[model samples]
Target: MIRLVLLLLLAAGPALADRPRDPGGSVALRVLEIAALEARGEEKRVAGDCLSACTMYLGLSTACFEPDAVLGFHGPRLAWGLPMTPATFEAVTRTMAAYYPPRIARRFLDDWRHTPRFARVEASRLIARGEARACD
Candidate 1:
């Protein structure tokens, strides 16, 4: 019975793995996309630079990073792409808090408050801080 169950699980793995890749998009759009992917049991593997809105994928249930992966974070801005106003900053903080682990979300919000430039977080640091697992 155990072997039969194992075989069944193995056979089901491919179908889960066959989910389509997420086409990259804006921060808000990507959040929806990642949620869909999570619903399908898909995991995100960060192999390269994941900047700005791309860093939002870190919130996924199973997000892993290659050794060289880098993530960039900054405050959200207006539609015209100017710096965020206080309200926009609060909104962005709320969005991130909803998505990321509390510690990471707080750190990110603090960083956003401190700097207007993109803050780079390395994969090693993320792994060390338990924000992301190292990809196999």
Candidate 2:
């Protein structure tokens, strides 16, 4: 029953893109792209640098990362480094953390979410920690 429903959703979206190969960009665009990929219900493999908003790929149930793939993360920023409301910051932080497993999510919320520098988490470590599976 659920399998049929998932297949129906997959039929509705365009094919998933080739392995999300980019340094990352507009959060809004990535959000839409991720939704489409998630709906497609296909495996997503990450083999290269997926930084910034690109890290959101982890949100998808089918997403996998090659051992060497680098997924970078940092705090949200506004245009011209403008300040967002406290609520907005918290919301964005939670959204990003939501992609990770609970233990890592806590680490992200505690340290990485507000860092000025990007926090790099290797796919190997993610696989070791059971946060993600290795790509075939």
Which one is best on TM-score?
2
Q: Can you give the lDDT of residue 45 in candidate 1?
A: 86
Cα lDDT for residue 59, candidate 2: 80
Per-model C-alpha RMSD: 13.9, 14.1
Error of 2 at 99 (Å): 1.5
- Cα TM-score of candidate 2: 0.76
- Per-prediction TM-score to the true structure, in the order listed: 0.70, 0.76
Q: In candidate 2, what are the lDDT values of residues 16-132, reduced to their tens digit? A: 443445677767787788788889887888877778777877787888889988888887778788988989888887877777788777887899878998899888998898888
Error of 1 at 106 (Å): 1.5
- The whole-model C-alpha lDDT of candidate 2 against the native structure comes to 0.80
lDDT of 2 at 125: 91
lDDT of 1 by residue, 1-136 (tens): 9999999989998975653323234667877888898999888788666766677777887778886777767766556666767886787667755666677688777676357776777778888888778998
lDDT over C-alpha atoms for residue 117 of model 2? 85
lDDT of each: 0.72, 0.80
